[model samples]
Target chain A: MKELLEKIFENIYSNGLSEERYCDIKEFISEKLISEYNDYVMNREIVAKNKVNTLDIVLPNAKVGDYYSQLLKIEDEEIIEYWIEGLKKTGLEVVSEIVLDFQKEDNTMVQGSANLEVFDNDNIECQKQVIGTKNKGLVIKGNPIMSGDFDLTLKYKYKGWFDGCNILERKLRFAINPDPRSLWKDIPTDKNIKFYKDDFVSEYVTVLANDKGLQKDIVAASKRGRSHAHEGKARDDDFKLYHNDENGWYIIAVADGAGSAKYSRKGSEIACETSVEYCKQALQMPTELEETILELSKAEEGYSNRSISTLIYNIIGGAAHKAHRAILDVVKANEDQVRDYATTLLLAICKKFDFGWFVASFWVGDGAMCIYDKERQYIKLLGTPDGGEYAGQTRFLTMPEIFTPESIMSRLKYSIEEDFSALILMTDGVSDPFFETDANLNKVEKWNELWENINKEVDLTDDNSESKNQLLNWLDFWSAGNHDDRTIAILY
Target chain B: MRRLPVYLLIDTSGSMRGEPIESVKVGIESMISTLRQDPYALETVNISIITYDRDVKIIFPLTPLDELQLPDIVTPDSGPTHTGAALEKLCSQVEKEVKLSTPEQKGDWMPLLFIMTDGHPSDIMIYNQVIKKVKQHNFASIIACAAGMKAKVEPLKQLTNEVYSLDTMDSSSFKKFFKWVSDLIEVGNKSIGATDELLLPTPPEEMNRII
Candidate 1:
């Protein structure tokens, strides 16, 4: 202890060091190898599987879209070997390694030594390898046709619902009633094109919602997002602006891409828009599984049969339908137009009445959903597995044909809370995160893995607005949240 | 003398914008400086800072009188209040960090966590699990505060014993809060008292209290 103090005294007396630099040295030197490996257990994943390059490191049973991996910390070389043995017991190739290091100062007595893991990849990248970062966001890559890209973004603020985790707003839109110019490149001029309402609706609402997220209003747009040099993506995904008594409430959406779809963005937008519209229509009077699913799916399918294969799972109750086809090889009416066009969907129906607020949801498929209750300690689960494959190393969701659930009921409820602010809807792209894989575990251990100790993370931010933005960016495998084409929508 | 491990859980969540955020950042530096100045506190108080803005980021793990350094944290623009996520992480982190400390290596007393949140969790519901983990470990006695956010105090009550609310967000209140926090640390270090004494500002008397 005296020697340690003497070294500190010398550094204090030294003329060539700043306190910040000194602190960094201590952090770099002291964090050791073991804890870092433990941290690796909560992150890592494969976001997009667009068939970009063949050398994409596909795990034995890994898929191209929506995969996750976690790293578990092991000490004794023998115990680690045994853990790997346990994994092999499951009859799968579990890749893992450990990193060791010793700390020293001025070549004196050793303080301690540590053995930790460098990195880990498992379960077809079904979970993000656990890691820590200075900035907030997930690290993931996907190929969305014509664009072979890797997405590295943070998940800022979010409103966790049964349907989807909504990313908070981050920009200015001058979203007023205006006219449209050239938004989409190849839109034939004569084919029912009206940009004015879309422009005005998008513009006015965005600005008003922007003000609502101001610092004075409890939450605000990310300062980094508004920085002059910032040219971050202006996502038109899962966003809508509504007004009440001259105040604006923006509704955002988060949708996951289907593993078997050629074009997921189209499915994502359709699911979000149609779900939001359905809830709006049902607001006057609520109905049931027969009306909500059969009728709603019919309505969406009626609109040119383009959305027939899309799963319409809503959280404000009334969410129904079969899980997928489960590799059984049976085509429905929706497949007549698009060959095996299917998507995993989850929806949230939120309505803030005089009695706190009420939101319910229903879901199916190998997706996920979470709800932060009024007490903050209670998180409700949504989008449980609907029986494609849920055992051993055999995970599901690679193709819509793998979905199969016959008798379906409503996995929905209503909450009586006055502080309600938002609703969220997402595709498997957003929901795939909850079903993660780790070095010590797999999808079969979902309940045992999260078991109380998993959701806890120390967020330093005091305002949720900033937190929301970070959540949006962090939902990837690398950033923080489960890796996927994370779309977060917050209604305030 | 009583040993107190003062864990500072700062909300680096992006919502804490501008000078207020800056002031909290500076306040962390000040807390370290002030704690270092007090010989008793310096000897007995162990400090660690866990910053969570977007992700549950641990700026530094728990360090004792032997190896301690005030970190250089770059304040980001935004972060998600994965408060529950952070807590869940801290549960494991604290357990791992504690395992590193033996009766001969560090103090044997339990750690104390001061969770300062200006808002609620961006990702909901999962915090229940986090809170349950924290309570299960009994690793630290939590002191939660709703700093600048129109925070959901009801939720804060579910996690800790001492939950305070700050009136009108500002730098002064933060400084004072830290001052009171440091004072408690000083007192706790100087004496063997189990309960630390903190001169905290009171919330509006009329505010409805949950716990």
Candidate 2:
């Protein structure tokens, strides 16, 4: 049983679906057990009938199948012994029990005992008692002879009234060189164990910052990161980069498609594209509002910062509305659901002001935008996450609030800052690994750690052509075991 | 990374002997097969089954559907409805099984529970205590289904706000109810990390009514 299990685990790690691996194991055990039972029945046909008749003479209508079923029943300790002997024949030493501590409190690998069981062909064990109090991953104990695999079978009793026993099988496969950040904690460093990676890592430049005529190196990059889907999810989160050198303005917009949404990838692509286009159009708006926007921030009267804030608000708010309408248009034409294209939007436009730089940022939902200053060496978060009624629930660009002015004012968040180093925009996929939650978004160390990690992948000190490719590649780094699509855009 | 664990507490006293028991078995199997078809549910949902007769039995521990086998549920020959014992067992299981989040690690999704019964509890006082204990587990959702003519609703109301009474106890009604539960689970799989209670699929008005 041990050798067969080890071989199956190896095959599963090499090239087999976990689902099929389980099915294959089950088939093997059933065949072996049934074949053994068949041999026993065939060998003692006359002796079994004579012994059964002597043991129960009153039994008038009992067939050979009934006798065999009774003998194989879980309630019969002798049948269990036969299974143990079968396991022994397969070179597995059976123990009374073994324990499993899912919460390895001591951070130790080995701890408890486990009970063994055998199914048709899949030899595994059903967990006897789960005593973990916290949410740690698999931990096996009780010195077993097996390496790279463990087997436990459930002992389900079958009555004479029932036809067959109901047994379940479970097998554990640990990764050989597991990532320390893996959610599956404390994986043993066994040579045979290997993390399931169907897709090999590849390098490519999806987008790069195009500095045609700018004051400084405006670094911006976006790439489809590793996700639940290997070759990139059918729908990837998106970012739209806009460089309006004519207007002395640069815009970067990112949209994260909800994993649950069917057409969200398209929605994100459209949202980022539409939002950035609108921001460019907003800059093209008559300079008449600029004087009013400039005046309102200075005035301390009725609505201080209201005029300028409102002007920036209308640009972002109108852009959000356009994105929403665009999604609605797709839904209407396709006869699909608005929720199917649900996505979160984050847009930022930086204008090369005479003083330094005037930046206007807007967002609606999770993810984050930050202002990093090289001189001050500090990171400032633009806004808090608009986590809706639920953790996964967030305000989408397709929400009805995007249409109404009043609701849009309340729902949309806008911020303006000067004397900043760079403008950073990202989807939740990139933000979540560094910042566990929105509340932790302002943690400078977390941001610094991200910066350090990125530097490890790319030389940020030298802002050259290679920096763009390096940033795009760096965006694909695996972190915190989250495989969601990642997108980040920066005007540095 | 964490699975969404769902618990099913079933009552299998003497009264649920023939068609009712068989229908339930078939209904549960159908639910499993249906849930398996959904990609999100297939990746995340883990199910546990516990049955109560004169005593409580954990037919299956929480397990992912990929590795699950549909167990044969048998009706006891003659035993009282030990619903209290079942509730107590559920409370203990919740404590033993539910994972809590730590500073460095995210926890399992809040567990969802379903209690199905056809008769009144033989031990009311004990049932009340266990129900209160179960509530402290802070389950994501708790739904109770009262079936058959003798099944009452008032007791179930105390356990959870999501209580439904089957209009009739038959194979078809059982089938519909199970399908509703399966659909609800599938929808839940899409938003497993939501803080608010999910918008569950409504049960058929003709076959089941809210308490």
Best by lDDT: 2
Name the TM-score of candidate 2. 0.55
Separate DockQ for every predicted complex? 0.01, 0.07
Query: How much is the lDDT of residue A491 in candidate 1?
Result: 40
Q: Report model 1's interface C-alpha RMSD after superposition on the true interface residues.
A: 26.7
Q: How would you encode candidate 1's per-residue C-alpha lDDT over A179-269 as one tens digit per residue?
A: 1111112222222321111110111122322333331111111111110011121221233223232222122223333322333323434
Model 1: DockQ vs. true structure: 0.01
Query: Which CAPRI quality tier does the interface of model 2 achieve?
Result: incorrect
**In candidate 2, how many Å is residue B49 off?**
5.4
Tell me the alpha-carbon RMSD of every candidate: 32.4, 19.1
lDDT (10s digit) by residue, model 2, range A1-492: 767876867776776457776778779888999999878655544443333223321101111111211121122322222121122212233332222444343445444533222222223346333211112211222222222111233222111213343321222121111122222222222333221211212222222334533354455555544334432335347777766656566777888877667667678878987888887888875385566645544555465465666786778778888888888898898888888778888887766554345566777767788887766777767666665322354677777865677666665544345566567787777787787655567677777777677668765542455676777777767653355567776666
- Superposed by TM-score, candidate 2 places the C-alpha of residue A52 at a distance from the truth, in angstroms, of 28
